[model samples]
Target: MSDGWILGLDLGTSGLRGVITDETGEIHAEAAAPLTDQSPTTWSAALSGVLLELKPHLSRVHHIIADATSSTVMLWDNGVSSPVLMYDDGRATQEYAAIRDQLPADSAAHGATSTLSKVLWLRNHCPVSSGTRIAHQVDWLNAQFLGFPPPTDWNNALKLGYDPIREQWPDVIEQLLSPLSPPKVVPSGTPLGSVQEAVQDTWGFPHQCTVHAGTTDSIAGFLAAGAQALGDAVSSLGTTLALKIVSERPIFSPSHGIYSHRLGRRWLAGGASNVGGGSLLEMFSLEQVRALSKRQPGPKRGIACYPLRGVGERFPEADAKKAGLWPDKHLPEAVRFQAIVEALVAIEKKGYERLHALGAPAPQRIFCVGGGCRNAMWQRLRSAQLPHVVAQTVERPPAWGVTRLLADEGP
Candidate 1:
């Protein structure tokens, strides 16, 4: 295990990406394939394509770990099920309504996008077979190598009603999953089973290579930032702005889109704001954004803009009918864009304050990832707003995070 390489794969909505790395975090090779669709067939073929692309180093690989979109679910008997339920698929409203009232406000299972809701919907539409089992996106792929349905990781099982705090499924889940069996759940890095002989022959992996459980894509991304102790924080400035801080205690505010995900021995508590890069893109082109950000250090526009691309706010505040505010249109585009950036930093600041108010400690240091991280002005603005919080940069490839699980879990 010490001498061989570790392969970490990420089953993303758009593509499958992987990196081959050693225990010390030195990357040897990387491979990726576009996912035509989020189907088992597509994932199987894409995984093979990636492995074949990295065939030259396959013999040196010892451990395999993978992360996928949380809440994306499927079924398995002897074979995998069809019409995969995607993470964003909200067709389970009826099922969600039936059980949502029964779940606590803090419960991850209280949404239409939850895995429990999707599985309940699937069970209702399709007859459940005797040996059928529930599987997450990564769980189904792990089965290809293990030769049977494998246990899912805690991160992927959260919305499936497997409580991380108790480390077991509650009695309430039985009401929703009457006929189907939940996967035996484990922590993020627990080794499940060895790669089957046939898979080793086909993919050129070692005979005894192990496949370990992985987390949700978001958690994997968080792990990549290297926040180890309590109060360490990481922010993702993607299509949506996500804020997370490692805390000694769990925080739950589902109404504001805030909650906690167990991160090893601690809890990661934060929230997601609907206002993010998407809102910026609505008024300016990519080039315009970059140009405006570069000129930010020289800006004198004192105007403030509250730009919300969507109908409501989720994090920092909970309002379904919230409206966005914009500065006067007569102002120069440069001034306007700078105002938007300042607004975002305000929103991000408000978010952290909200977390602190809800029980999370003040952030010790903050690391940022995603498309917005490239904005030098935004980083500067964040520093100015949260003057006490140390700002650091880190590589944010989620596949790299999945690899850490194997590296940290010693033989």
Candidate 2:
């Protein structure tokens, strides 16, 4: 055992979370700071505040890894690695068209959610800052520790059009992203550099600490759940349902809205859908949703509702119309709600089954996470849908997985 601990930082959409994890994947101390706003200055200050909170435990910590929202993007100044643009700062909407036009017809085009697409937008709109080193959320946060540019993890880079299978950035992309050298890419667990001496001194961290390249939050959650088997999978049920299955190769699903993310040696193929418990919240308050769910009107009356809380969906674009509940013989409101829940669960099941049909093997067990995990009704319904498959809940925040990668700690 290495006589050191690993620090896991999760740059969450809402806040910056820091955890000091030992080799056994146990969190020693955890701290959190809500982001005042999704701005570079805000994030940097929040991160520094978190470091201060964790400073007391710095002596034993020797490694640092981070997991962040994949959608987060920023313009990194090459000189000081300063962020000129924030990830959630969507001022670059106009620049999306420039890159979308350039993308090959068959190849995927990252939407406004991608770091690359956002950078392309920023470059055009803010022409003076065109030469900045743009990086994803985790990479940018990691960079602050070393006071230098940080490398992006493979899983995090996959959406940015980095070809993980080839283990290199594509030539076509390089030629297209001319003038800007490909951002340094590294494996998720690779030790890039050590915490800078200045940071160490200020934060009271060990001088020997080495920071490892981590992954996106979803990838980290998958790791924490020990989704290692060929068919093991994880489902994160939040505002949107994000599901991933471990596979040997990428499963393309531009039609069904599935995208693949490389997690270590395996590929995590899945999709996100607009249908989640959030729909219930949108319609009713959280307490109301819980109260309504407790009503428990037995099995649904077959009223299918593609509950979409958003304007459009990346998957099953046809559902953009916000189709209402299918009327069937005076089904009770409680029954209709149950039916909607079943339909949403069925959508995720369909996504998994589609991936299997597309050549990826079906998962034997599904590890559940996020808010949905607490709902016994949903769990029972999901289990009933796939009677043979196991559904287990492991209440781990995504930060735990980042700690594993940074610490090289096995489950």
Candidate 3:
């Protein structure tokens, strides 16, 4: 491969981000656009807005790849799109319940929010014919540029019942979804040939520019953090704290909400904690949280706090009725804040312990990302608890990692 620019697009729930990078993985330009809803067209506009920002570099961009939130999918008939299903869309409760007993606890398809459930929900309520197929978020976006939806990556196919171990779609899922099938599966970084001439003309890119497969948003973030070796991990401290580690083998435990994503030859496995920055903010405003985090946090406070935000807890333990347990209101506000922050740290600690108990290696080194990772005091708190949490980090936009996919000289 010769020297040329590459584009990595990330279609996140809150927004869409794109980065232009050289073949060396050095980022040159980055752009983003806001997203208001789950509409597929919104994703397209966001992509165009980002590309327009880098229009000057579009011609030199020879390869393009993208990542989208895992499980966000829509149905396609022949070649047209249906209403998109957001990742958190959980209207598949009945369907999930029907099959939940049949699946082993280790199955990724055991949740209502899973692609497997969402597709079943659509099938039961919506109509489907011979040409009908489920398309993940990235798949739909790729279809726009490729003239038809190309194959999906293995990482995105995980929640859709593609067995990475078997390297094929399992018969159980195939039989269940009989008519409602998943898109063709491919490993991340597989080139899908040239861009549609119309898209090429509209985007001002060369007709020969290729579109390559990309993975899930979280998986892209893992790659962006540059943690590839065994035991390397990432803790995304965003709305929720998510843990993922590189392991030689896969790990899955429906009990603890743990599931592994197939990445090349290794596996990225861990669960997410319901309590994190969002929970922290519920106790105080963003500004107040920032200001409070700068304080000493005062010896983990005598008063304990669970600080859960919603009705259920998945990681560290699974309880459908779990609710936030807060310190008394009469207590000093700052003290309560410290207790909550400490509680969040505790959840992070136990999440990793859960992964370890399930056979994943203890994190040799952890690279943190997300908005909360910027909190200096929070890092201090985490480092004090988990020494392996790296202070200095190289967290790139998720887009940057997907760019590496097409930037590579692989097939």
Q: Which model scores highest in TM-score?
A: 3
| Per-prediction TM-score to the true structure, in the order listed | 0.93, 0.90, 0.95
Considering TM-score, where higher is better, how would the candidates rank from best to worst? Answer: 3, 1, 2
RMSD of 3: 1.9
Q: Give the alpha carbon lDDT tens digit for every residue of 255-325 in model 3.
A: 78888988777888988878888987787898888888888756764566788887888887877788879
Comparing 2 and 3 by lDDT, which wins? 3
TM-score of model 3 (CA atoms): 0.95
- Residue 57 of candidate 2: its Cα lDDT? 93
lDDT, candidate 1, 1-411, per-residue tens: 365788988888999988999998888999999998878889989988998899889888888989999889987667848579998798998998889778866787877778999999899988578888888999987887789888899889988887778888888887669888777888878889899999899878998799988888888787787766778888898878889898888888877778787777789888788788877898889988888877646555667677898677778876768889887778778777778888898999989988998899998888888888888888888888874555566775888877876665421
Task: Give RMSD to native, each candidate.
Answer: 2.3, 3.0, 1.9
After superposing candidate 3, which stretches have Cα over 4 Å from the reference?
Answer: 1-3, 406-411
List, residue by residue over 182-234, the lDDT tens digit for candidate 2. 68788888888988998888888888888888888888888777666788888
Poorest 10 consecutive residues of model 2 by lDDT?
316-325
